[model samples]
Target: MRRLGSALLAVSMFAGCGGLETEPSPESLTSPSFESQQAPITTTDVDVAPECKGIITFVNTATFQTLDAYLPSNVVTNLVNRRATAPFTSLADVSSVSLVGETRLKQLEQGARARGAINSTCVGIFDGLALSTSDAAAIVSLVNTIDDSELHDVLPDAWNGAANLLNLRPFTSAQAISNVAGIGEVSFRNIRNAATLSRPFEALAAAVNAIPSNGSAGVQLKRHFDWWNEVTAQHGYSQGGPTCFGLEPSSVPYGATIRPYLANSAEVMAEVQSTLDYVDADTKISPNVIAAGMANLSARTQGRSFKGCIFSYADDPWSRHNVAIFVDTVNGFSVFSETWWAE
Candidate 1:
């Protein structure tokens, strides 16, 4: 694909499948059910001023060309010919391209529609880039402009309520938006099928990009945890000593960033269930004991984030899965066990 110079539309093609090399986790088996995903996106021709953050529909990838400084002219030529990348169906496909990266990728993918129209005149979606989460209202307002749109039904009231209350962060993929608010299964399916969602992000995409990743979350956790080095040093759990020391909680900064990409909260809720699983096998506890265990440890947070709390409590863990066990935060009297959600 690279030999043909296909870097024009959001960078070189990464694969025949949607962009990211990683496949949807085992949970994504459900994607096919709502998979009536159209090949070409659908859009209305309301001529929007670039200042309005209008959606630019690129009906055909095979003939699209742009000379703006995004990609080499030669690469754009290759994409126009389909000699390099396959027809881009969604941002998921373009996002996988190696060179596009998140910033430019968001701009191009959000600005241009796929397999739909031949729009050459619309907002220069990628003109300037900035990140922030306060744009959801404006973005939603822009989406509302899509006359006779179905988005209102798809996202629903409660989900929007969750968005407003939590000040839900901006998100890139339908997969990621599924993360924050209490957007449940039915809504998620409708969204995954909302193919045009790739383009009409308006200001939403910018804010989503601004939100931090798990990697950054991990970094902050470790930084705040510098205060706990004293506690870890005395218990033989010193940084890099035996267990969680110097384990780089920062490496998992995206822990909180897990919502959209997580696709669902069962993974988040699993944090609690995992503790139960471990307790079930590791200890011969009953329903009564399990209830008491949670009742006792639930208040131990001391206002710390779930994962890095100096103290860890396992209501009951079947075994460790994604969560990590360590004295990196704090170990309580070497009690039952210390467990926290690992992003």
Candidate 2:
């Protein structure tokens, strides 16, 4: 197999390009041309623990609620105040659409898709490309897991090797949450440098949204191949190899033994409490449920940050397929809330 440096150089030379115009860092590639509206999805009902009955009330969180708490809603109206913002790239294909006055936009999406290829980490990248209603339904059918059509999988590959995405790439859930402060900058930089490609923000957004919330670290690594070309084009160098080829590979987070919990309400409470206790006692990091929710929203808003926390649900409220809550991809961390909720 080709090494990373060799592969990248080979890919770049074959494409007849040494490098496209250097663009701003991923931090500067913030902001999409369109504005996204936030709507709340119905939450699944879970029994509340008596110990925390009133403390954990229902908070209606819409798609919009997950922003960095810095961007204004009416971005279009306040063009001057509107900062660059990466729009959420849902898992749908729109390459064949023919909306009035949107021909160029459709071409843009298609070009972005072709330019920003897929990888092992984002094997589902094509699934996230925004498309017409027919295409959306088709992609939804392929997901085959969740019932909700809107909840497309956020595969981890979205935030990997591309040099421009370095700022957006996250190593941990906490880092993902903290990166929101600079999303606008990333969005701007991506758009400014689109001449090298077409629409970096759109392409990157599609990659980010295609990440699945559940999968092994290997699945995550596989998706990394999809974007190899984009990485070479962006960095002005050729490189290739398995996504996580050289980096010392590690197990997904929370992929180990699970703690047992009773099915009763009080048991559920104890279970959740225990999970938090485990996070605190063992890793020195307690579960920050609210903060996690916000981080997910922020990641969606910026269309970047691919780190997520996956909790295992079999026994421990935080049980993952294993332990350490391995990130399926690079998007925002998943809280794996089912493990903590009342059964």
Candidate 3:
């Protein structure tokens, strides 16, 4: 779990599962299924080029744009920005180390493989690191050259699609729209599970270190982690006060940096059924009204992410869950109800 060079560590060891947490909100539990999740694959031969030791994968914006030599790198921004904090330190730091014994990790792995068949919403697999499409393509191209294999052959197609969907930024009215259509939010869990994103981006570290000091990758990496820490720890809801503020912190200068880590339209559709559980009770009105209530609760509690999951109309109960509710550039909003999604 050590942070090597500019690359943040991405490995997962038995972080104490603080007792089966609590049931997801009623909206999240409508499906009535608790299939298992898979554990990530572990590898020792990550393979870093000796010549690429000084190369930095992330650039430090404070240093890069301002020409400051003392600032930390930007890679930390990416990690902290996404609200991914260390759930556990060394395996021994867990409150109940016995719960995460060898048997648990094995069970988690099997559960992950089995849950792969279900719809994306039903599967919450996050390895903690995600890549935009441009970034994915960049990595794919790198893999093809260094590992000599197709990215899909090594990673899932969903992963690729998610990546492309992530870097889809705002352009003028007359810009190209290829993968932008039907794009929703990319699941944070999926990106975290990438074979290349294994805990502790050591390979990436070696690569960055191989590059010259002039290379900005190291600085970029520092920003990414710092941002990630801020976002994950930030409150998801904002109160109306003298000044407007976001519930989450921003590591990346712009909100657009993390927009892709959301549920896409397809994934949003899949979650409609379960999202009902998070709705506020007072909003209830009809058949499957529970779902509607869940959505409402998710919208209010989970913040704007769920707001994107708006239904076609507000009155009809089923209609409420029919259409995906999205706002602006953000996608799937239901996942923001962390209280509902927890075990």
Q: TM-score for model 2? A: 0.19
lDDT per residue (tens digit) for residues 161-274 in model 2: 222234343323222322344323233222111111112222322333344433322111111121222222232111111122111123211122222221222322233334
lDDT of 3 by residue, 287-341 (tens): 3443433343333233332212111212222212122222212221122111111
**Which 10 consecutive residues of model 1 have the lowest summed lDDT?**
1-10
Global lDDT scores for all candidate models: 0.29, 0.22, 0.25
Model 1 error, position 260 (Å): 36
Model 1 error, position 207 (Å): 30
- Model 2: ten consecutive residues of lowest lDDT: 5-14
TM-score of each: 0.24, 0.19, 0.18
Best by lDDT: 1
Best by TM-score: 1
Q: How many residue pairs clash in each candidate?
A: 30, 82, 99
| Model 3 residue 1 lDDT score | 11
